[model samples]
Target: MILHIGQQKSGTTYLQEVLGHVAGPLAETAGILYPASIREVLPDAVESHERATSGLLGTEYPWISAERAADERAKWPRLMARVRAWPGTALLSAEALSTIRSPAVARVAAEFAGAEVAVVVTTRSLDRSLPSLWQQHVRNGRVSTVGEFFDLLARQRDRGPAAIEREHGLHLWRAFALGGLVRRWAAQVGPERVRVVVNPGSPPDLLWRRFATAIGARHCADLPSDDVRTHRAHRGLTHVEAELVLALNRAIGEAGWSRYEGRAIREEILQHGLLPRTDRGPRVAVPMPARKRVAAWAEEDLADLRATGVRVVGNLDELQCSAEPQDVDQPPVAPEEVAQAAAAAIMAVASRDRYAPALRRRGWRARLGSRA
Candidate 1:
């Protein structure tokens, strides 16, 4: 079994999308099955077994109800059953698995006790990942300003990984503290069995090709990396759009909306109302000091990572932190920009509703014609 335990925001969604689509063909050609059951639980989405992995860990993610967690918990066994049934190499990919602690890691290791388990971790440069990480938190209902977010990260850095993991369940370093993460898994699964694939930041599918090589599915390495069709559910948020969403999150909380209700409304606004619009503002950038700090942290982590002698699929030099500081150091988002973004989001939601009935009617007629 190959487990692609991910470092989130590192082209993971793209890779998972490809894996889900090519499961059948890949199985036929290379005897590698990205099991159909992973998608069967959420057939409408190619989320790559996140729920199953979450169930395995019993992670109490924010806003997840007890009923939902139990339902997902039940899926773990069913997923395992399908994996046991498959004769060929089976693959499961989930970014959430990377956040697990040492004990959880051991539990996971024991689950595939008799099976040949190989772990693959996809990573990106720390310099480049900070903005994306912050945006993700904002989307998840954080109202922290970029400066405040970096300040919190600095404090977390001072406290170290254990404290960070204990206090903040989904902190960036839980996954991106590369050296610690590698060491923990290596202890469980053996250093030789774990392969780290570094993001090279180009051509998009390079990550997938390296991933394919790591798992011994070389035939599928050269498959059209661009042709896989999947929803861009976690698209990167731009500066203005992120600020707008952050404001909305704050407003929702202040209005006394329940976390679950806020999440539903927030996601709807993000998917249909905000994300659908073109990203028209400046991209998020780290200030000079924070950039330097993260770059140094990456250096230390990479040094520790090298000492472990874990197998690496791509150039370690690619993971080096060399991002140049941007002109603005966490610039204040303009109120006008926020307003413009809010207006666009409102229009987007309104237009979607306006056309939804017509689109449904067209689909109905098409179905009738097919029946005829």
Candidate 2:
């Protein structure tokens, strides 16, 4: 069993996107089984096998209902039975698996008892992860400011593994505190079987090829890495667009929008609508003050990662932040820029058929206006 555990936002999404395409006869010829059974979870299981891992551990998310959780848990054992029966190599890639506790880790180890299990973890520098994570947090409907989010993470950077894992909302650290994550899996599967693939943040295929090499499937490395789906892979939101979404998230809460309604608007109107228009804008970079602290924290974590003796596939030095700290503060996102972003999102939403009716447009306008 090749278990691709993830440190989220570390090219995991792109890797999973590519894997989903080749998981059938294409992968079978290469002696890899990416498993079409992932579709059993349907609407939820699109790229990664996160739902299955969530089911196996019974991990609760903010969105999962008790009934839905029960159904997911029921599906896990059946999935494992099929995996156990497969004679050749089977691959299970789930970023959620990286966050499991010691007991849950043991449960995972026991579940795959008969197979030779190798664990693969993908990692990125702390500087790169923070901004991406804050955007994701906003996308999930939270209204925390990027500054507020980074400040909290900077303070918690030095905390012990167990301490950070206990707190909710610090999900990024629970997985990307590379030393702890690698050590935990190494303890269960042995250091030799634990492979760490460092993302170089460059030519896209480099990360894909490194990942394929980690899984001992060199042939799969040459497969197409492009995400050709109608809804393409997520690109980072520009500074102005992120702030606009943050503003909209606050409004959604003030208007008491239900979870489903907020999610739909976020995905359809803000994500698809507003985001595409702002690609040329500057991306949200790590704040000057936070960069030094994160660099120091990353150095400490990488030192510990080196001590784990697990095989590393790329230059561990690539994890370091070479940019020197600057004295200037990032310019505040301009009001006009944010307004333009909002207009773009509104225009995109207005163009869609489901929201094209004047009544629906008026309804949306009224809801947002009420909060204003």
- Candidate 2 lDDT at 222 equals 59
**Model 1, 265-352: lDDT tens per residue?**
8787777777766655776777566777877888988998999899999999987876465554456678887887898777655665
Cα shift from native, residue 364, model 2 (Å): 23
Tens digits of lDDT, candidate 2, 92-211: 888877766666677888988877899999988777776788888887888888879888886675566777666544455768789988888888889999999998877667887898
The lDDT of each candidate is 0.79, 0.76
TM-score of each predicted structure versus truth:
0.85, 0.86
Q: After superposition, how far is residue 306 of candidate 1 from its true place, in Å?
A: 0.8
Q: Which candidate's lDDT is highest?
A: 1
Report clash pairs, candidate 2. none
Error of 1 at 176 (Å): 1.1
Model 1, runs deviating above 4 Å: 60-68, 161-171, 229-233, 327-336, 350-372
